[model samples]
Target: MRAAVVGAGPAGMVAADRLASGGAEVVVLEATGAVGGRTRSVLLGPGHRLDTGASWLAGFYSEALAYCSGLAMLRRDVTGTPQLVVGGRRYPAPFEPGVLARSPLLGPTEKLRFARWVAGVLARRRRPHVGPPRRADADRADRIDADTAIREAVGAAAAEYVLRPAFETMVFADLADLSAAFVEGWIRAAFDGRYRVPAEGMDAPWRRLAARLEVRCGVEVTEVRPQGPGGGVVVEPVGTFDAAVVAVPAPVAARIVPPGVPGRPAWLGELRHAPHVLAYAARPHPDPPPASDVHPAGAGRHRVGSVALYPGGDGRVPVGMQGATVSAEGWWSDELLAAGLDDRALAAALWDEGRRLEPGLFGLEEATVLHVARHPHAVPVFGPGHLARLAAWSPCPPVALAGDWTCYPCVEGAVRSGRRAAEVLLTAGR
Candidate 1:
C-alpha cells in the first residue's frame, strides 16, 4: 500500500515514518524549502545557526525523547534564577525555595494565597469524576475564561506580576477569551518542572527523521482531494495513496483539504493559530549573572515581555556556544504582527526594548549578527469550548488528521496525534 503524509512537521514526519516502517511506500510533502515546519533553525552568520522556533525539547516530551534516543540534550537553568529589574532596581526572582517569603515580586500573604489557589486548581483539575458526574457533569471549570480564573484565584496583583508575564512569553492570549481548562492543563505541564533543548537547534531531531524518510521539500500542495470512483486519496498531482495523513496547521489544513472530505473535521476551518515574532542573535561573552530564560517585571519597561538565552551557543557561531537569543513580548510583538511591518523596523524596536532590560543581553558588546523569524500561525490557541469541539470528533477514514492542535498543544500531543493517524491507516488494511 502507498501512503501520503502532507506537511513535513513533527506530526507529518511521524506519520510518514510510521507508515514506512509498517511496509507501506510513503511520500512526505513539504511546502517550505525545509521539513521542520515551526521546528526550524535560521542562520545569523556563516556557520551560525539558531533555533528561532519551537526552542525547547522539554523533559515531559516522551515522544521526542523516545524518538531521538541518542541525540544529545542540553539544559540551561535560566528561569530558575531569573533577574527582574523594576524601576532600575534588580531583584532576584527565582522559582525556588522561600521566594514568596523573601522576594519582592509579591507580598507574603498574597504569595501564600496564590500558591494555595494553584494547589486547589490543580486538585480540582485532577479530581476524578464519580459515576453520573462523568456522564452528565457540567463543569464550570471548563467553561470559565482563564483570565477570570487567574484573577479570582490568585488575585489581580499576583496574576499581573507573575502569571501574565509567563503566559505572554509562551504566547500572547486575551485570557478573557481563552479557556480555563486549557490554561490549567498547560500550567499543570509546567508543574513537572523540566526543560531540555537539542544540542543542535530545534530542527535537530526532525532533520534526522527527514533524512531517513522519503521527504519531498519545496513542493506546494495546493489541494488534497479523494480520487472519485477510484477509492483512494489523490494528493493533487503528487500521486494516489491507499491512505493519507493531513498534519498541517489547522488553518492551512482547512484550505488544502476540500470541504466535506471524509475524515476532515469542519472545526479545522473555524480555528485560528497564534502569531509569534522572535529575534535571535550571537554574542561572545557569558551573559553577566542571570541569563537562562529571564522574564523582567516589565514594570518600568513594558515592551520587553520576557527574554531568553540558550545556555550553550550553537557551536557554529563565533561566540562558540556562549551566544544568546532575545525576544520581545506583550505589545511589542502583538502591535506589528500580521500588519506588514518591515523586518528592520520590527527587529530594531524589539532590540531597543531588550537592550534596556539587560545591558548584558547583547553579551560583551552589541550583537554581531541578528536574525528575526515571524510565525503567523505559530501556536494553536485552545479557547473556550475548543475541547468540547474536540470531544465530538470522529474520523471519516482513508484520510486521518493529526497535529499538536488535534490534542493538547504540546510536543507529546503532536507525536501522539501522528502515531494515531498512522494507526488509523494501518487499521484500515486498504
Candidate 2:
C-alpha cells in the first residue's frame, strides 16, 4: 500500500514511521526546510544548540521517550525545586506537601482549600489513556473555564499565585481561556515522573527518525482529496496514494482539506491557538549561576512568562557560560507580534523582562542574543466543550487527521494521534 504524510512534525513523522513498519510505501512532505516541526533546535554558537521550541520531556511522554531510546538522555535536575515569582517575591513551588505547608505564596486557609481541591481531583483521577477523552468523562467541570473553577475552589490568591502560573507555563494560555476538564487532567498528570532532555538536542529523536525515512522538505501540499472509495491524492506534486494523513495544525488542515471528507469536524476551522515568543541568550555566569527556573505570574507589568536556565554542564551551552531561553506570556506575545518589532528588539525586550524578574540571576549586562523564535500557532487551547467535541470525532479510511490538536497539546498527544491515524489506515487497507 502507498501512503502520504503531510507536515513533518512529530505527528507526521511518527505516522510515516508506523506506515513503513506496516510494510507500506510512505512519503512525508514538509513545508519547511526542516523536520521536527515545533520540536526544532537551532545552533547557539560554535558548539552549542538550544531548543527554541518544545524543551522538556515529561516522564509521561512514553512514545517520544521510546522513539529516542537510542540517544543519550540527561535527567533535568532543575525540576525538583522550581521557583514561582508573584507580587515581586519568589517561592519554592515543588509538589511536596511539606514544601507547600511552609511556602508563603498562599495563606493557611487558602492552602487548606487548595489541598482539598487537589485531593478531590486526584481521588477521581482515571488511568492515563491515549486519544481524545471519552464523553463519559464530561461533567460540570467540563462546561466551565479553568480560571473560574480554580478561583472558586481555592481563593483568588491561590489561583493567581500558585496554580495559574504553573499551568500557563505548560499550555501557554491563560487559565480563563482553558477548560476545567483539561486543567484537571494536567493536574492529575503533573509530577508523575522526572523531566529529561536529549543530550544532542530536543529534536534529536525526530531527526534520527527522519533520517531513516523518505522525507521531502520545502514541499507545500496545496490540496488533499479523496480520489475514489479508499484512496486519496495530494495536489501539488500530485500522486495517488492508498491513504493520506493530514498532520499539520488545525487551521492549516482546514484550508488544505476540501469539503466532503469523511469524519472531518465542522468546527475544525474554529480551533484557537496561543502565540509564543522565545528569545535565546548567552553570557558568562556568576559563581553558582541560577539553578532554578523562574515562572512569574500575577505580577503587574511583567511581560516575561518563564526563564529556563541552562547551566553549561548539559550540552546546551559552552563551558563557563550560562544559556537561557526567555518566553513571553501568551497575551503579551500577541501584543509583541502586533507591535511588529524586529528580532533584535524583541529579544532585547524579553531579556529585559527576564532580568527584571530575576535581577540577581539574569544580571547578564552583556548577554548576546543567540536567536529568537516566534510561533503563531504554538499550542491548541482546549476551551469549554472542546474535549467533548474531540471525543465524538474519528478518522475514516481514505483521509485521516492527526495532530496534538486532535488530542491534548503535547508530544505525547502528537505521538498517540499519529499512531492512531496509521492504525486506521492499516486496518482499512487490510
Candidate of highest TM-score: 2
Per-residue lDDT for 85-113 in model 2, tens only?
87678887735678889888878898889
How high a TM-score does candidate 2 get?
Answer: 0.93
Candidate 2 colliding pairs, count: 0
Name the top lDDT candidate. Answer: 2
Any idea what lDDT model 1 has? 0.70
> In model 1, which regions exceed 4 Å deviation?
43-48, 77-85, 90-97, 125-139, 228-230, 286-292, 296-302, 310-322, 330-334, 339-342, 363-365
Among all windows of 10 consecutive residues in model 2, the one with the lowest summed lDDT is 127-136
lDDT, candidates in the order shown: 0.70, 0.81
TM-score of each: 0.87, 0.93
Question: Which regions of candidate 2 are displaced past 4 Å?
Answer: 77-79, 126-131, 135-139, 286-288, 299-302, 361-365
